[model samples]
Target chain A: MIGEARIVKLDNLTLLVIMVGTILAMSIFLPERFLTVTNFQSMSSQFPEYGLFAMAIMLTMITGGIDLSVVSVANLSGVAGALVLASHVKAQAMGISPGTIIFLAILAALVVSLICGWFNGLLITAVGVPAIIATLGTNGLFMGIAIILTEGHGIRGFPEEFLFIGSGTILGIPMPLIIFIGVALLVSLMLKKSAQGFKMYMLGSSPLVTRFSGISNNRVIVKTYLMSGLLAGIAAIIIISRVNSMRPGYGYAYLLLAVLLAILGGTNPEGGRGGVLGLCMAIVILQVLQSGLNILSFSPFLKKFIWGLILILFMVVNYYQTNGWPMRNLVRGGVKTGAS
Target chain B: MISKLFQRNETYLFFVIMAFSFFVTVMNPSFLTVENMFDLVKSSSGMAILAIAFFVGLLSRGIDISFPAIAIAGQYIAVNALIAMGVDSLPLAFLISCAVGTAMGATNAFFISSFRMQALIVTLGTSNIFHGALLVFVGTRAINTGKLPHCFKAFGHMNVLTLARPDGTLYGLSVFAVLLLFVIILTWFILNHTLLGKSIYAVGGNYESAKRAGFNIKRTLFFVYGYIGFLSGIMGVMHLSLIRYSNPNYIVDTELLRVIAAVVIGGARITGGSGTLTGTLLGVIMMVILEKNLVLIGLSSYWHQFFIGLVIVLGVSITYYQSKRQNRRNLLFTD
Candidate 1:
């Protein structure tokens, strides 16, 4: 038990140290911009949107599954919200009140995202496709639907109210940032203290035993997917509101980022082993890294290269620690045996 | 008779491809032209290589979503190397480009084998890192491959042979198309015949069992990732040759979907332990032909991406259902 605790404790604390270091580095490097109230506000605002994506992905990861379609689903919801709002007002038309539209738009997006997630879940659970393939297939399907609806164009001219939800400031605090923090706290509670979260871990860690324990396996899967979809919908609103436009191609970039955030935060791809705190920190670290690179005049391509290199390094390190390095195989009378 | 039916499950994806081809051809009369077919094959070559590469990892019961970016990085680096070295020879340039890709593959393997980290996560990280490194190395602008060497130009533009009708319509085969076919044949041979190749399937089927049977799962993973990197390297070279330029922005959502679809459509089971190079080739062709035909029939290029995704989902669903039923039947028989 002591040995196990050491491993678990190390994994949990690793990201906390990293996040603190990032904050320190940024404050020192770009003192005025990075440490300011305005900067924090701006950073926090963007966090909720990306955080929502991270949450959705986290839900799937906890279920021993993944959803590549989150980005596509978010894109669809963003476009749908924009289109519905735009078509009504005719001049970047928005006939609905700002608050009402925000609620309705999010609801609509969540419903669509849920349906898409359900489709993916059905394929994985019922048709028995692997999570990667099922999600990959639906990723294409959702994005394709977005393309048909938007015809490669964008939906713009949203009502001022929607923008406020994304951009509005309350007593020098960004609304999006507030929303993001609120959601994060809520999710952390659910994961850390809730009965369902424990059950989720049991299912993820040992589905066979858990099923024998009488957990509704299928319902749990569907429920996780539903939550993932809802989170995706929330991300859709924040993203479109931030950008002030909705393109069919939106959220394409977020797919990889969301996965990175989840894993970088210390959520295991093998499932039943991870934390939301680590993921949130990972997101902040990634965003800071991107911001730093941007400030340094690095080209976008260079940014991708940096991201990839770090990813590879971290993975290699993770692999070594988990499975012991320099893996050796046996030889049977001059014939080489395999490495485990 | 029942045994024969289960054996045919592997080949069912081909029927789907043929049906799609027929449907597209019916929608547009000119869809079956030799030139169009050649172009389709050429367009798919880069992604086809990736699909084959991906098949390696899948057979090992692991997945790498980062191959596309790796391919892009390899393409960027190789092209940059060529410009720096001032190489005018296509074959040598291709060789050097593949070497770079192989290095990337080795790096991926090192992490997976040495670190015990998840492939999905490692690849995801590297995808960003590789892309970022490429940008820093090459700067923001794309390297135009056509301006560099005459032989390199031929790689994208030159046709291997031509077929012409009395009516004077020029329809010919491309060297790139031939190259794609050769690669496919080579992959099928390796995957089917080689001891190392058979090990991949064995490991993916059941890693614990394979280990007990004296297989090196680590070495298998290393080789699988290395092979994928090699494919990506070849693709990087091929993609730069075809497009005549390397653009970082080109690594977008559409690219990931298309490449993955090609692999999944080729009848490669997502769960691993089962896949074929032939199936991947067909999947690549099906995707390319469908996209081309859709555009030819007046569907927007934007819509093509969306529709292709739908087709992949539908195709996979059908395949998954069929396999499930077959599995159930086998269970029943055993019982």
Candidate 2:
């Protein structure tokens, strides 16, 4: 039993080692510039948008549900922010302060994101639609709304101050990276220490048992998705700022990547297991691989293929770890073994 | 009579489709014409075929979101192979596509059956890999099939029956639409008549009980996923034939949602073990009609997505409520 526990504990550590190994391998094979500060800065800046979305997905996955509409929500929120900024910039020509406009735009984006999250919660809990189905529907709905609002064109030309939130550095660190760190810290604290977090894990492990224990599973689920929505909102701000544009189709590819990251981070798809630290390591590894691929001039599609391969490989590893090697039983003619 | 009809899931969908069609026709009488009606069916044939794949996967308690990717990949392979060989045989192209699709499906089945992973995640990973491979191996250029033999082009546009419009354009029943009907009948027969079909339901209904009953659960899952892939390949070929071109990026994103929505709306329970081909057929028609008429009703193509999403949630909600009520009734009776 102790040996099994030790092996289980080493899973995340093994993942970290694999991540570091990949980075080291990339550094050796690639040019000297690969390890330079500028490359690290660019990689760090590029990863936070995806990293933030992964964290959002991780929060919901912890509760045994998924938020498939994270990208759509982010797009919707970002579009809302962009519209606000675009209109406000026009007002700026009439002497309105850019600072206040930027603040208001940010607030608008976050608020829209919260509402979208709340709506997802209502669909799952109140309407009794399964999380995956509900979010799949809402994903379309949100993206459609964004398209209708923007008429299929990207909204661009944001104020310099707003762009700084995405592109500017503080203490030689990219702003988006700093924001990701702060969000990661807060999420980790919530998952590790909060009563709600405990309840989420329990609910994920056994919904019926949690309900019988007098915990309102509905409320927890709602709160969990709401947090996911909020994170997507934050991710939207970073993405829009980073690109200096907002469009309905922005970050469409990241939806799959976010799910991939969360799963690679060792979060159980069925829920009730995983942590922020594991997720952070997973994000860094993927970001490094992505940056490495970029430096090596690999096709973007190859990167997607690698992420997909990793997702399947990790799921297989996780299954074996949790279920205790199905092949052992297969070899033994389906007889139960004490070790299994 | 109404209550009895309502008790049957397909009937409710049929009425909904009828009501929706009536509303659309009322808004724009042009939509009521025979040509327009046939055109709608013709265009929807591809989606209906894809939905059939979705229906099969859902029935066996596994959801395959990779069908669209598989379809595009298979089509690309078939088209490129035909182009390289300088052949214009539609049947040969279809055969090649199905073969490629079977391989892709078998890959999904291998991992899913061997590992017992969640079908959703497995398919998601495979989808990315398939699309990525398509981009890397085949390249993203849209290949025009204009150089194909005249017979092949003629077959693609072949109409069984024709109706001449007042404006001198002719519209008629397409070969693809006929193919869809044949597929629907074949799938219905498989689901309702065959022993393998029975095994599929049994496995989905209760995995442990099915195992005890001597059913090979892994084999059933493998066969179901493979069958869906096979159908997806056919759909892919049909899609290429209809469009007269092949593009790697075609049918990437929103197509998956549409297929899922159609299956769910057709009264298939997401939890698995219960669904019917007839119900699925009605569901596909309803979705296709709504999509086609949305533009006629002055809504842009964008709103079509919003409505599809709305219908899926509403459809699932109704199913959830109905099932809950049934469970309550059963519990009360047992008590």
Find the candidate with the highest lDDT and give its number: 2
Q: Write the per-residue lDDT of candidate 1 for residues A1-340, one digit (tens) a residue.
A: 4664566577667777888898889879888767677667666776677678888888788878888788888988787777766654653243455566566677777678778778777777777676777877777788778878888788887777778878888898888777777778877787779877787777777777777788877677777777787778778878888888888776555666777677777666777766777777788888787766656778666665665666555655555556555443223423543432
User: Tens digits of per-residue lDDT for model 1 on B53-117?
Assistant: 88778788767876777777776666666677877677776777677677777777777766666
What TM-score would each prediction reach against the true structure? 0.89, 0.94
Q: Write the per-residue lDDT of candidate 2 for residues A161-237, one digit (tens) a residue.
A: 88999999999999999999999999999987999998987877788888878898889999998999999999999
All candidates: DockQ? 0.52, 0.53
Instruction: Report how far residue A281 has shifted in candidate 1, in Å.
Output: 3.3
**Model 1: which docking level applies?**
medium
RMSD of every prediction = 4.9, 3.0
**What's chain A's TM-score in each predicted model?**
0.88, 0.93
CA displacement after TM-score superposition, residue A146 of candidate 2 (Å):
0.8
Assess candidate 2 and give its lDDT: 0.85
